[model samples]
Target: MTEEQLQALLHEMTTAEKVGQLTQFAGAFYSEQEDSTPVTGRIEFPVEEDMIKESGSVLGVAGAMKLMGIQREHLKKSRLGIPLLFMADVINGFETIFPIPLGLGATWDPALIEELQTISAKEAASAGLHISFAPMADLVRDPRWGRVMESTGEDPLLNSLFAAATVRGLQGKDSLIANDRVGACVKHFAAYGLAEGGRDYNTVDLSERELRDKHLPAYKAALEAGVKLVMTAFNTVDSIPATANSTLLRDLLRGELQFDGVVISDFGAVQELIPHGVAENEAEAAKKALEAGVDIDMMSLSYAHSLASLIDEHMIDSTFIDEAVLRVLQLKNELGLFEDPYRGVSLEKEQTVVGHPSHLALAQTVAEKSMVLLKNENVLPLDKQTSVALIGPYADNQDLLGEWSIFGKTDQTTTLRQAVQKQYTHAIYAKGSQLYERDEELLKEAIAAMEQTDCLLLALGEGKDRSGEGRSRSSITLAPCQIELARLAKETGKPVIVALFNARPLDLTELEPYADAILECWHPGSEGAKAVVAILSGKVNPSGKLTMSFPRATGQIPVYYNAYQTGRPLPPGSNERFFSRYIDIPNEPLYPFGFGLSYTSFGYSNRSLSSAKWDGSGILTVSVDITNIGEVKGDEIVQLYIQDVVGEVVRPVKELKSFQKVSLSPGETKTVTFEISHDMLQYYHSDLTFASDPGQFRVYVNGSSVCEEENTLTFSLVKS
Candidate 1:
């Protein structure tokens, strides 16, 4: 339909019909139930039959035939025969799950991530899903926040790159909402990652400068990449709930960012305004959200029950409802739903594409590149003929798919023991202990297996349910029983290799002492086990890096690499008690960001600069020589970091500017070059001005964020 025809249809919509276009319900709302009451969060309210038919969209429902039945029935009662849009939380993958978003970030390969998301889009679109609430752009610095698994990491620049890549992958490079593609929704609008105490749904307090500099860039990148929709956060921004914050939604998101796309609330967030103390009742919640430019209310009745009456009572203008309804209609038309309601949904195609062998192969490659080698004391790359013992809660368990994989099944996932058996016929398996509990019989069996094998590969970490939405933890450490299991295995004097399967960064203080090698295998989706075996057998070298820093202890909750310099900063190896240093522990993380290990070592030498000064408008080229000095062929992620010597505000010690993944044969030498422009040095000032100042800068080129003095080069930025 043309814009004129959509406007004409909008003019024919009744007040109730317009409000219905702004309301969304879940799959269960359309099912027959004895209780006519519908629940949103904790509150239950009566939903009339007509309200169901008038709803603009449905959530948590999929499958080609099922959606066809719902849409066929819905159009019969829609009066104007408008088709309902189907949305789901297809965060990481649709059926053939990939590693959690954090693990994907560890690859430092946005091009690979784009390919993975394209496969995800194809699978999801085949299953009749029109929208995927994914590519979460929240900048997370705290590991205690369970939702960190959904984010790409803590750095704004890297997150922005991945966010844009995700959008392009899901929506297609041409921005066409084609039959094989699904529209992407960049989520949580603003800074939901900075929740205080790292608790889920907690308060977020930050300056507008902080919000703009560190948090808002990724969402803007997604929108700039042509995302079709935006989802509001469940938390507050500047003390106002994001769903009702006019400054955030209207001025920043829509006005300044120029996003004319559809805006929808997070699940039940509109009704949640009452508990947040921002609204007196549901009616007031509807008024505030609509005024704040929220277009659709998800799993909430506030819009359906109050919007028409608010317009009738002159409490709100009817234009708000009309404008929102038009956006909804426009999205449907853009999706080509008006022409073919099914939109190429076919059960045969869904079955053929989802979880296909090619898709699983890609998932395996991603999982292999995402597994970080945190510690290796000559215990990794085990000989294929070596006898190994696979023990712990995850030994034979199939909960390899991480949280937010709504469509992935555990039955389809391969377990560590199964993969080990396939790789090495001399391997034995035992369940040492439950995740959070101890059992003497299980311990004895595990110790027997450990004594019988030449090496111990302990599979341990939080369960699949431990990290995702609303699964925050006060202490981010392994359970005591699992720790004890590791201790007992170490007593046998066999080489202990810890393969950690988790979501967020964990406190490795307890388990670090006993392991000869530690592999941070984050919830590696369907082909995770196969990838792990391949790495262990020397078929694949570990090349993944840490995106989020691992805290030494739970006390270091919000630790990250790109922290601002402090006055009276503690000098390295200094014993001064008066400086800004922790008395109980060192301030450094257990594992810093961009830190990882490969089977082979690479040596850096001879750093050079094109010029000593940049005139602020031209590019300055920096180069360094990297050679594979070890005996094995491997891939290395060379990172480039910059430090602004002086600024209007305190700058980070070092910020990641660029990175490159290079494959090198043994004894091969390669020179990696980077071009730095004036825009790379810009920062948000006290007055919110984003520009670089004339100053001296230090550049470091190495394999990780921690750079040695010899690897650093000095340069200056002069006024144009």
Candidate 2:
């Protein structure tokens, strides 16, 4: 924009007017689902969408603006005459929800992830939303942490790439364009996953190295992708709340990285700092925040109330206020709002265009691609004549779309029972439990259903409400009643298939042993029912792998595959004293990362690598032959992982370098190959420099992260 226009905007703002831009309010309007998913909380709100525009030349407002019509009328009343940007928690979908992120991560495909977010953005942008809080980049280790379902997984490198992909999907080339896309916000700026005791909104005490190497890669990747905005975490990093940490705000984010976008706080995060004891009062919280470079406050009155006095006292510089307001205005300018504030406003096309069938198709493709077959014993892909019994709270559930599916229509999506009834001639269903049920009647019903059918499909797991933000579990086990029903089903002598509708992994020791097949369906959105049907009818082959590790028990709370080995290593085949291995149970998780099963089997040749080559100019080709040993056709994700033979410091035993998802006809042999460049082999070392060292390398081509067969390569990194 012309400096003249910017100066004109700043010139009209009184200290009070400018302070108004700094504080954001949650409009009283809210939305809630009726006939809610059992475990999903009863939090509801009215759709007051207009409160946003009514407040200002915007300062900005979270969704449910108090009055749709009035908000527009009054927003023009502001001194600066700018429109408010409507913000909301567009976690998975706005209207056409997709599967939860963890489930998407299980697919381990960035291209598909980018595609789904593209669909999500289209639906959300059409609904008058200007910005969406999405693509959560937390590196989760504990399944007990309910929000684990929201992040990708525990690997920094993989999650980093996904984070960037999500940003690109939502923001398109220019979200701030005329009806093109909505702005994307990469969230919880710091390490929110390290919350104390794996609880949400808890304190985080972490070393700088750990912070940079592990929790910060995703955010850096998002920044590099040109994300228009950033959000602060709710917890403290070291001793300072992330919302008010100047080092994170000014020194690192702005000074070092040169991120020119506005910094938005997490929901009510600015005020939350007061209760965190970092700030004395709301007024002080505002002082610390504006000083720390937080440009916008979400759902908090702190900035709205105290910024004027801070500015008058010279405690907060006018230049800082100018910088903050300019960032918001620059976005408005980028969005061409200066040209026309009504760019995205429309009601005539809303009815027919928003949740149409094309949108449903996109959701279905994502759901189909995201479903991971965790365990298969040939109980899946049943013939049309098989008399199957579908049982579980989720079997008949109208809410199969999954977590973070905020605006989805339950009736529109297909249910497991409905999908099954359409296929089998004599399919029966039983609730078994209330999802958290331990009642005897439910168990009796489940057993009865199992007795009537030749096979059983139990859909018992966490409900949609049990695994999002502010939702953590003390026990990562199957709900009590489901276990009893599962135990009983084991004795029925029928082939049992467990369809898990949970966001995170469960302690399947009691459940897995009793099941012949298991499908981890993490809340497939709108086409969720259709995706389940595809898997059941063998229309779409399930090839998704686990991005997160499934622990054998809660005792392995922070379980993950790529974790650092304990100083005293546990011998896999031998027992040694004082090692990290548990006495009663093995330290290994129930399933390793990149772990999945297919209807057909695959074979991997022992890995082979070429001799050493130069770092900057060399290309490493690692190939594998995957044969479909089963009669049916299928797809396989051949994984290639590399280990640094030696490094300046200890490193993960192996890191996933490249993978290919190949579809093969029955008995069709295909060669899958990946090229490893210097960038793929580099790691951040003691000096914070990333490089591929001059040393030998070991490569493994296997089905997943845990490779039973492998080979080696010798490569050197000469100066480029």
Candidate 3:
């Protein structure tokens, strides 16, 4: 439908139908239960059957058969014949699950991540989803928040790159009109990741400069990439809830960001405005949301129940309603739903494409690349011929696809026991300990199993239910039982290989001492076990780097590599007083961002600069020769970090400007080059101006964010 046709349809819609276009409900309402049975997220709305028939969208129904049925049922009851848009939280994958977004960030390969999203889009589109609230571009600094599993990482540049890539992958070149794609919704609008104390739905208060500089870039990048929708955060932005804060939703997101796409509320967020103490009741909730330019209300009946009355009572302008309804209608038309209500959804296509071998293969490849070998003292690349004991709750568990796998089937997932048996024929398996409990019998059985084997492969970490959405942990340490079990296993004098299955980073300071090798295998999706076993058996090399820092203690919650340099800085060898040093522990991260171990070593040498000075418009090229000195072929992520000696405002100690992931065989030398552009030096000044100031800069090229290599080059950025 064209714009004129959409307007005609809008004119034909009744006030209830227009309100319906701005409202969303679960597919269960259209079913026999109506309001009795609940759908996803357990939110039960008091939706009338008439409202269900006339509603604009369905919340969480997937699979072609179900979606086709619900959509057909909806159109039959929809008086204006406006197609009901299908939306779901297809965060990482649809059926063949990939690693969580954090793990995807660890790969540091946007091209590969884009391909994974492309695969995800195909599977989701075939399953009859018109839109996915995914590619969560929130920059998270605190690991205590469960939703960190959904975000890419903490850095603005890295998050921005992945955000754009995800938007491109999901929407593709045609931007969701294509039959093989689905619309991408970048969320949770602004910075919901900076929740207070890393708790979900907490307050977020920051300066306008901090907001623009640190938290808003990823969402900006996603919008620039043409994301079809933006989901509002549940928490307050500068003491105002995002769902009702016009300053953020209207003045910032829609105005400054120039995001004309539809703005959506997080699950039940608009309704919570009453409890947030901003709105008095549902009527005010509806008024605030519409006035703030929220296009769709997910699972909140506030719009359906109060929107029409508010418009009639002159509490809300009818033009706001029309504009919101028009955006919804436009999106439906953009999705080609008006042309074909079914939109190429077929049960056969869903089954054929969802869990295909190729899709699983890609998931395995991504999972292998997402595994970070955090520590290896020559115990990794386990010998297949040696008798290995695979012990822990995750040893044979199929619950590896962490939370938010709404459509994932764990039975179809490959378990570590199955993969281990296939790779190491003499492997003995034992369930050592539960995630948070101690079982003496299980521990004894595990020790006995370890005694019979040549090496102990302890698979331990948080359960799948431990993280994502509302699941936040005060202490991100391994369970006491698991730590105790690991120590007992180490007493057997066998080399311990700890395989951690978790969502966010954990305090591995305790486990690191007893374990000979540690693999940070974060909730690797359906093919998690296979990829992990492959890395252990030397079939694949570990290449994933950490996007977030792993702290030594829970006290150090909000640690990142790009932190500001303190006035009283602590030097490398400074144990002096009056410095910014922690009395109890070091202020450094246990494992810094971009830190990962490969099967082999790479040596950096002969770092040089193309020019000692350059104008604002000129490019400064930095080059370094990397050699794979170790015996095995491996891939290394050569990172380039820049430090501004002086700035208009204070800057981070170092910022990651660019990086290159290079593959090299033993004794092979390859030159990795990075071009630093003028735009790369731009920063949000104290005046909120985003421009670079001419200054002296130091560039460092090495294998990780906190590179040990002393290869540094100095250059000056002259004014144009």
Count the clashes in each prediction: 0, 15, 0
lDDT of each: 0.91, 0.76, 0.88
Looking at candidate 2, what is the lDDT of residue 409? Answer: 76
RMSD of 1: 1.7
lDDT of 2 by residue, 301-375 (tens): 677667777888877778988889888878767766666565555665455557777877888887787888888
Return the TM-score for each candidate structure.
Answer: 0.98, 0.93, 0.98
For each candidate in turn, give its C-alpha RMSD to the true structure in angstroms.
1.7, 3.5, 1.4
lDDT minimum window of 10 residues, candidate 3? 31-40
Candidate 3 lDDT score relative to the true structure: 0.88
Off by over 4 Å in 2: 1-3, 29-70, 175-178, 612-616, 709-720
Top candidate when judged by lDDT against the true structure: 1
